[model samples]
Target: MAKLKDKRREKISVATEIDRLEERRSRCQDNLERAEFRSRKEKLTEKERQELEDEMAIMNERVQKLNKELDTLRGENRKNMLLSIALLAISAFFYYIFFYNEEDP
Candidate 1:
């Protein structure tokens, strides 16, 4: 029971973290898009343009990192599911061997 609760809590926490990361990534993407539009539509000093480019680069990196983290979390969830299935199969096998018996008439 405790283990189950722990797993549930951990799953919830991981899901929450993923949600937060996704939100952050979305915001960064929006910012990047706005910056791109601004760069295309307006004239700027060379220094300002360079700064905007740097900011866009940082945003891109952040988006990539978030995507990688999300993928890793998804993979971990898959691994956990597989492990749970394996455990259930093992438990069922043991139960069948130990508890399921036929009586002779």
Candidate 2:
């Protein structure tokens, strides 16, 4: 039960992190789109263009990092699930050995 709670907490935190990263990425994309539209009408100054590029790079890096973290969390969850299954199986085996019996005539 404690492990279950821990897993739930971890999942919640990961979900929250994913939501935050996605929100940030969307905001960055919106800014880039606006900048592109503006540039099409006129032209971006060199510094403005550089800043946009930097923001894009930073957003990409953050997305990649978030993806990696999510993968790691998935792996950990898989491992824990397997461990739990093994533990349950062992307990069941012990239960059968101790409690199961055949009738003797």
Candidate 3:
């Protein structure tokens, strides 16, 4: 009976140690994430400051890839807008010169 009690106490001790380690790990993770967020926040430029709302969206989670995707989307949108405007202007000029000649020869 004494041996069984000792074994049970050993098991309880091990369980408590595991719980303590888990708590420490959770605290460490929280601190690390907070520090990372602080560091990233402190390094923004004025342009980036305007887009900090976007950074907050990704936060510390999946941020690198999300930021890359956001940048890519913004680039693509800008390129597409310039392409669209160029096409519109070229078409307007072509239409005017080909169909609306004011000189009668």
Candidate 4:
């Protein structure tokens, strides 16, 4: 089995991936913006329609990828939060059992 990554490293890895995804999304958005008020196809013929379809397809693919990346980021964040909570609880329990002695004893 692979060793589990520490929470900090996991967070950093997720953050890097998130940044890359956002960059790709921004590029896709830029492509669309650059194509605005202009024909995506070469001429006013079948080729032009095909070009438009291709652009649309690319845009849709990028959108889907971005959504997946966002979902992963959310999941990592949730895992980190839950892990922190669990650790805190475990630490408190240990303290109560050992270090937190009652003076009256």
The candidate that achieves the highest TM-score relative to the unseen native structure: 1
Name the best candidate (by lDDT). 1
Alpha-carbon RMSD to native, per candidate: 6.3, 6.8, 24.7, 5.9
Better of 3 and 4 by TM-score: 4
TM for candidate 2 is 0.58
Give one digit per residue, the lDDT tens place, for model 2 in 1-105: 999977876667544655665677577667667656665676779998788668767766765675676677667667877998999999999988877864557
lDDT of 3 at 73: 51
Q: Which stretch of 10 consecutive residues in model 1 shows the poorest summed lDDT? A: 9-18
- Candidate 2 residue-wise lDDT at 43: 72
> What residue runs in model 4 are displaced by over 4 Å at the alpha carbon?
1-12, 40-46
Q: Can you list the residue pairs that collide in candidate 1?
A: none
Residues 9-76 of candidate 4: C-alpha lDDT, one tens digit per residue: 45566667677678888888777666543564335577876787688678878878797878888798
RMSD of 1: 6.3
Clashing pairs in 2: none
Question: Residues 6-97, candidate 1, lDDT per residue (tens digit)?
Answer: 78767685667678778988998999999999999999999999999999999899989999998997788778889989999999999888
lDDT of each: 0.87, 0.71, 0.62, 0.75
C-alpha positional error of residue 46 in candidate 1 after TM-score superposition, expressed in Å? 1.7
TM-score of 1: 0.70
